[model samples]
Target: MKLLLKNTRTLTENGEFEACDVLIVENMVQTISSFIEIEDVDRIIDCQERLLVPGFIDVHIHLREPGGEHKETIKTGTKAAARGGFTTVCAMPNTNPVPDKLETVQQLLERIKNDALVRVLPYAAITKGLKGEELTNIDQLSKLDIFGFTDDGVGIQAADAMYRAMQLAAQNGKAIVAHCEDNSIVYGGVVHDGAVSKRLDLPGIPSLSESVQIARDVLLAEATGCHYHVCHVSTKESVRVIRDAKKAGIKVTAEVTPHHLLLSEDAIEQDDANFKMNPPLRSKEDQDALLEGLLEGTIDFIATDHAPHSSDEKAQGMLHAPFGIVGLETAFPLLYTYLVKQNKITLKQLVDWLTIKPASIFGLPYGKLAANVVADLTLIDVEREMNIDKHTFYSKGKNTPFHNWNVTGVPVLTICDGEIVYEEDFHV
Candidate 1:
């Protein structure tokens, strides 16, 4: 089917918005110009002067399938991604039977082929069963259609194990996406080790717990020449280390979550599990550093880290509740409202962080809105303001801290590969 998106302001290469129309014909962007003669088009969408940009790409998300479908599935998770303006998302390997072997990776591919509404790229495990004891067959897994390797939920604890994994990843020409945390320093903490934890009398997770591991990995990556990507960075020290690594010409990249950028440990309220997450929200100083890193290009991009858990698991409160909160549905709106509207960053920069930057890091072909590129696009109503209600989310997880927050810039239409996967009812 041929689809034409009209009356929209599209983002340009020069970081300016230009009025143009996009034409998609059966999976690729056929044309993008000021005016295209409409003929034989199956559908024409009136965008009403809204913004049309490349679809968002999230490099970190947990589609709890193959084992934790009760929390989320490929179908539901992709639907949530579509509603959030993301056309592609990399699924973490922390599923029931981890995608450590070829068979497990194949299983995930089959499920994504059958169930995903948007594109789903699976990451193979860095360690066997993600136990950090044995390295997986990176050479064999790299041959499969997988997106690098990572043990997302758990950090690789042993330096020798991590060094070996980096060596293997370097040999295979693949990245080792790391969840940097030193277990020895964690000490059963649930929140950031700062004034909030002290005042609340809660176990504190020290900032060094995250930065120490990042510091070690930076050296290993420098030594082995591996493309090391840090996951969900939350500390000021980690940002500084990453900056220095890049200055020293190390092949290192990092991503910051919306929560880490927007909130801090001071936002945590008593007994609210929604505020809990791994590498827990750091102090205000750390948050400021993360923002600066993003603006200065030390942070590569923004990812949702869209983890989901059962309601009962989250209802256990701060002490016992699992770390994570659903992010896919709120990432864009929250960022646009808080960052762009507050003059912290330009709209183009925000869009690039969600689009081209991630695509460049992952070497994917779905982040540009040009001819011959895949028709992965999103139209957002930047003027619309709506309260965030988790009940309205497509994913089963209703564990977000942004509840009742009024935010602008809601996604109204998402088209993936020439198909209209999600469209909001503007009449409502």
Candidate 2:
């Protein structure tokens, strides 16, 4: 069936907004012009001058399927992702039976084939069971349809092990997505080591724990000439190191979460676990540096790291709770309201960060709205203001700190592969 979305404002190839109509035939964008002639179209959606952009892609998200379904499953998590205007999400390898072996990767693929609503790409584990001792079968796993290699919940502590992994990835034409943390330096701290930790008398996680490892990985990346991607970068010094590495022509790219760009440790007024996360929120100076890095293109893109834990687990207060919070449901609204509205970055820049940047980095082919491309699109109401309510979330994990925060920019319709996967009924 053919679908025509009419009277929408779209970002052009030159980063300017223009009025246009897009026509999707089957699973490809058939036409995109000011006036698409309606001929035998099965459906016509009046976009009402809303913003139409490429479907957002989140490269780092934990679906927690095959093992930890109590927190979130592929079905529920992909629904949440579609509601947030994401059409594709890369699933982390930290599942029950890690995707280290070919059988494990096939197991994940079978689950995605049966349960996924949006496109789900799984990452194979770098180490066997993510223990950081033995390497996984990267050569065989890369032959499958996996995205890359990562041991997301834990970092690769051994430098020689990481170098071997990078060499393997380089030979197989794949990336090594790293969760850079030297466990020896972490010292059992929960939150960022700063004034907030000092005031609350809580154990603090120092900035060195993140930057020091990043410094190590970039040198390894430069040595191996492999595509090394840093996940959820949260410190100012990390940004500086990444910037210098890029200048020196290292094949290194990094991403920053919205929480790191918007909120600081000062936002942790109480001992709530929702404010707690791995690579915990840093000081205001760190936040400013992250924002600057994003604007200057030092930071490659934005990923939610959308990890969801059970309510019972998060109710244990800040110190006892696990490190993570749900972000697939609120990432776009929060960033659009806070960053774009404040004039820190233009809407086009924000769209590129969420859409094209990550797609380009991961070598995916589904981030543009041009003719002959795959018809993955999202229509957003940028003027709509609503308070975030966790109860209304499609995700099982309602663990979020932005509840009741009034924000503009809601996704009204999401289309993946020319199919209407999600639609918000404004009239109702």
Candidate 3:
């Protein structure tokens, strides 16, 4: 089918255009010109001055399948991704059965292919059952279109095991997404070890707990020559360590969640369990440093850790509750409000981080508007505004702290691989 997207602000690698037209023939971009007079177009979406950028690719997300379906599932989670402008998302392997062995990974791939609305790329577990004691069959899984390998929910606590995993990953030409938390230092700590934790009388998770792990992983990556990716990075000290590692020419990349970029420990004063998440919100100093790193290109990507939990579980006290918030449905809105609207970054920069950069990092082929490239695109109404209603979310989990926040620039349509996966009718 032919799809023509006209009168849109198209974001490309070169730059952003005021108004242009993109012609998608079947599943690839046929033409991208200011004026493309064409007939027989199956769909002509009048973007009406909205931004028409490449569909985003999220490097981190938890599609709680194979278990934890009560929290989320591949079908529900990818629906959330479609609404949030993500055409593709890499799923963490920390599932119920845990995608450790080749069979588990294959099963996940088959399920995603059969059920998901958007592209679902599963990351194979680096260790068997993510136990961190034995390595998984990384090479066999890598041959099956697997995204990469990661023990996402838990970092490999043992250095020797981590190094072996890295060596195996390097040999298989796959990346290792590091969770970057040192469990040895983590002892009953809930939030960031800071003034707010002290004031709230909550257990504090120290910065070194993350930095120490990052420091170790950097050296390991340097030694093994593997592509190392830090997931949901939340500390200034960790940023410095990553910056230094990059300068030394190590293949290291890191991502910061919108929560880390937008909110800080001050929200903990709300004393709401919804504010709880792993690698909890940190200090103003750390937040500023993260923004700086993002601007300076030290930070590789902006991903929403996007973990979801049951409302009942979240309603428990912060100490007893699960750590996470649903993000796939709200990431773009939050970033547009906090980053683009505030003039902190250009829409092009945001698109780059969300689209091109992530695709490049994962070695996927969906982030460019070129002939023969897959037609995965997101259309946004820059002026659209709405109060987030958890009841309307496609995600099963409603654990977001931004439930009532008024947000602007919501996605109007999501197109994946020449299919109209999601479309929002303009309210009359």
Candidate 4:
């Protein structure tokens, strides 16, 4: 089938919007020109001047499947990713019967093939059962076209174990994606160690809990020559350590979540569990450093860390509730509103971080837009502001703090491999 996107406004190499039409034949882009005849098209959509770009890519997201289906699944999670303009999301391995061995990874690949609406690159576990004690067969699982290795929900607590994992991953030519947290330093803390935790009468999780682990791992990566990618970096100290590592020429890269960039501890009002997440929102100083790090190229890109939890579980309040909130459905709009509209980052910069930079980091081939490229594209309504209604979300987890917040740059249509994965009736 042929699809023609008409009257599209797309960014050019000069970072200016140019009016054009893109012709997609089956799963590939056939042409992108100022004017294209549309007689042979099976479907046509008038973009009406909305911005068109390569579909977004998220490097870190939790799609609870194989065990935690009550919270989320591959089907619901990928559908939510499509709604948010994401075409590819790397699924973290924190599931029941974790992807620690060949059979588990094979089973996950089969499930993704049957249920996923968007592309999901599954990460194999770094430690078997994610116990942070024994290493999984990294050499064996890496051959299954796995995304990488990670124990996302919990950090690898043992330095010797991490060192061995990094050596094996490096030998297999794969990245060791880390969830940087020292459980010993966490000290049963639920929120950032700052004024907010004190005001809420909650235990504080210190910045060192994240940074100290990162400092150790970067050095390990230096010795092992492994691609060390940090996930959901939330503290100023972590930023400084990463910046120094990058300057020292260590093979280190890092991602910041949308919430860490958009909200600080001050944004937390009361003991709402929706505000609770791992490596909890830090002080305004930490938040400002995160933005600066991104602008200065110290941070590589943004990821959702799109963790979802059941409502009953979240209602347990800040201390007892699970650590996480849904992000895939709200990442782009929220970032566009608070960061781009506020003149902190340009729209083009935001799009690059969400698209090409992430794909480049992970060596994925789907984040470019051109003739002959895969038809993984998305259209966004940059002018029309809409309130986020959790009821309208395709995700089972509506645990976002941005609900009811008015924002622009909402995704209107998303296409993956020439198929319409998500579309709205009309742009408002």
In order, the Cα lDDT scores of the candidates are 0.93, 0.93, 0.88, 0.93
Candidate 2: residue 105 lDDT (0-100) = 91
| Model 1 weakest 10-residue run by lDDT | 419-428
Candidate 1 ranges with C-alpha deviation above 4 Å: none
TM-score for predicted model 4 compared with the true structure: 0.99
What is the number of residue pairs that collide in model 1?
0
Give all candidate RMSDs, comma-separated. Answer: 1.0, 1.0, 1.3, 0.9
lDDT of 4 by residue, 272-370 (tens): 999999989999999999999999999999999999999999999998999998999899999999999999998889999999999988888888889
lDDT of 2 at 380: 96
Local error of candidate 1 at residue 418 (angstroms): 1.5
Which regions of candidate 3 are displaced past 4 Å? 12-16
Which residue pairs show collisions in model 1? Answer: none
Query: What's each prediction's TM-score?
Result: 0.99, 0.99, 0.97, 0.99
Ten-residue region with minimum lDDT total, candidate 4 = 419-428
lDDT of 2 by residue, 1-428 (tens): 89999999998767677999999999999999999887799999889889999999999999999899999999999999999999999999998898899998998999999999899999999999999989998889999999999999788999999999999999999999999888998888889999999988889999998999989999999999999999999999999999999999999999999889889999999889999899999999999999999999899999999999999999998889999999999999999999999998888889999999999988899888799999999999999998999999999999998989999999999998889999988544
| Alpha-carbon deviation at 107 in model 1, angstroms | 0.7
Which ten contiguous residues of candidate 3 have the minimum total lDDT? 10-19
Clashes of 4: 0
lDDT of 1 at 224: 98
lDDT of 1 by residue, 174-230 (tens): 999999999999999999988988888999999999999999999999999999999
